[model samples]
Structure formats: C-alpha cells, structure tokens
Target: MLIGTPTEFGAALERRRRELSLTQDDVASAIGVNRRVIGELERGKGSVRIEIALAVAQAVGLDVDLSART
Candidate 1:
C-alpha cells in the first residue's frame, strides 16, 4: 500500500499484526522495544523515531520501499 502519512503506516502495521496473530507485546519483544512504544507507533504518534518505526514495520513483515513521486 502507498502510505502517505504516519497514521496510514500505523494502520497498516496494526492490520498486518492482526493478520499474523501477533499481539503488541509480541511485536515489541521481537523488536526489543517497550510495549508502550508499540502502542504509540500503532496510534501513529508522529514523535516515533524512524529507526524504531522501521524496526516495528520489519517485525510485522512489512517492507518499506521509498520511490520518487512520478
């Protein structure tokens, strides 16, 4: 999906996690972050660090591809 904002990314992450049967804690443990962090990320908190967000995305089996706008 073409995620245009942090909110969009978070929604996608949440959906994928549910699809994979993973709890927020499960994703947090897998990425070595606090469960609260996962919660914040899922809520699309703009303050979330890019590295952590990317890590969470990977943990949930999401690949982020950046391309120039056409």
Candidate 2:
C-alpha cells in the first residue's frame, strides 16, 4: 500500500504487527519505548519523534521509501 499520510502509515504498521503476531507491548519492548507510545503510533499521532518512528518501522520490517510527492 502507498503510505501518503501518517494515519495511513500507522494502519500499515498495525497490519504488519498483526501479521507477525506482535502486540504493541512486544513491539515497544523491542524498540525501547513504552507501550503508550506504540498505542499513540497506531492511532496516528503526529507528535511522535522521527527517530522513534523510524525505529518502529524497522522493527516491523518496513522499508520506507521517500521520493518526490507526485
């Protein structure tokens, strides 16, 4: 899926986690974050730090591609 917005990216992360049988807590533990942060991420909270966001994405095996928005 094409992730165009934070909400869309959050949904994709949720789907990937589910597919991998990982709970929010599990992901948080792996990424050195609290479960609430994971919850916020799943809810598409825009205030999340980029470093944390990138770490979360990497933890879930997501490869982000940034390019011209067109």
Top TM-score: which candidate number? 1
- Predicted candidate 1 versus true structure: per-residue lDDT over 2-51, tens digit per residue: 99988898999999999999999999999898999998988989999999
Model 1: how far residue 50 lies from native, Å = 0.6
* Over 4 Å off, model 1: none
- Model 2, poorest ten-residue lDDT window? 1-10
TM-score of each: 0.96, 0.92
Candidate 2 regions exceeding 4 Å error are none
- List lDDT for all candidates, in order: 0.93, 0.90
lDDT of 2 at 69: 72
Q: What's the lDDT for candidate 1? A: 0.93
Residue lDDT tens for model 2, 8-42? 88899999999999999999999999999998888
